[model samples]
Target: MPHRTIELHVDRDSVAMGDDVVSHAGVLSAPRGTLLSAALELASPEIRSPGWSWVAVVDGATTAVWSVDHGVQLLVADRKLTRGPVDVFFRYFVQIDPAWLFDRLAHGVRADRRALEEEYAPIAREKYRAELRRRERELDGRFLSTECVDTLQHFGAEITLHADVACDFTHDGDAWSVRRADTMFQVFRGGGGPIASIRPHALGEAWLVGMLGASARTAAGRADLPDAEPLPGLELTASGGRWMSRGATVVQVRSELAARVAQLAYGRSVADLRALLDA
Candidate 1:
């Protein structure tokens, strides 16, 4: 199967001030039988908005308007339109919550007051009152903050295409380079995934040797390390190059071999490298 790139073009870049509703016009080019999905990321600490509505305009007329809980939905088609391009125009709006707006104003007022007090103590009392009034006036109108605008730009409408083609995946030859090994261990130590849960010391010498070979040792000594707690339904041998549970093997090691061993020991235990060497 051949790999193809899909492109999405949006007409507008920024939302208009005082208007929660934004207009978007775009075209999607993809192969036939590809699935398309759209999503919007509007969650931010500074802005709060209610659900949105999407309208698909066809032939200069309103074809459909959908009330979606969030701005994520699959584009369903009766037949695949892969042979050509598809034009899409839509509008969406979010209702800003009043309470959230008020909270933001209150926090801003407090922060301004503190800054004024530190700089001008004598006039701070009067300035704080005036600042509060100014904030209220600012809140009376609809507006988007700089932060909000930047957030919108980042989390705007995103369309993704899923192709029904097999990918010829190949590992990068440098995946197990020192840098990658460092990153993998960092993520493991930080408790980023399930593999991080296994105690490194419990891993069999066979696995450690594959990862670190004779250059590494557990606190219990290199030859007589304790057996790791068995993974459910996984019968691991005391000696093997690949992890019996997941078939993972240590592909490369460098100056950081000992450190990687220590990380794997505490992060997750696995089978020994001796299996691969013996084979």
Candidate 2:
């Protein structure tokens, strides 16, 4: 589905200041963001007036109602079906209460508020991103002096011998080097045209995935709740009123692997890194 963006609009003609902006429409461009948010009750927001009779504009056009309550009676379609006394109408929805009472006012307010997200969404996303950045910066401090060999081994380089059939390997101080993987192919095939080669980084996706696969430890502790979402890297077995949290999945990275991962980007430049890393 294509993502639809909604903007709150306080009708300059209807949702006016002091319940009257017809006399002063030009002087006051009806507030749309924070100032408009302060007008609604925080818990149960509603339009102060029932004069919000305008249909919703989707991508800048009037949208037809698809359904109301998803039931048989509500499937009826007609503008007069939603009519209230003297131009009071429901452009978006009609919320009938549990006792079958028409709760038109609340849902009417919800139309634009839901569109604008009550104007609270802007500040909420800002705070969330700021906090995440702060925690990331603090976590990256552990990798300033981390050893590359140790970090590489955390992703699996210690026991992994760089063994390719055509390439002669050399290991010195836990670091391996090679001239080219296609050297033997060139000598045998008598040097073909310009060639392409692919050698994934020493510690790459396979190594990261292997670390996860080999870490299933089967924890001894049991969970108090029998029904609960499984934790990452954990399996659950429900027996008598409690759940056994098996598969602890202890990834034995020297506690600093993530920090080192952050450090590895020390010199790279990426515009949208979203972290304290220079990249």
Best by lDDT: 1
All candidates' TM-scores? 0.21, 0.16
Q: Per-residue alpha-carbon lDDT of model 1 for 27-90, expressed as tens digits?
A: 5445455443331221111122343334333233333333433333323333333333344444
lDDT of 2: 0.26
**Model 2, range 1-279, lDDT digits (tens) per residue?**
422322232222334347453331121122233221221111111343231223332224332222222211121122221111111122433222211212232244333535433344465546545654555445443211123334334434442222222111122232322222332111011133312111232222222222222221112132211222222332334344332232222111222322132223222222112122111
The 10-residue segment of model 2 with minimum total lDDT is 80-89
Candidate 1 least-lDDT 10 residues: 161-170
Query: Against the unseen true structure, what C-alpha lDDT does each candidate score?
Result: 0.30, 0.26
Q: Superposing all C-alpha atoms, what RMSD in Å does each candidate have to the true structure?
A: 23.4, 23.5
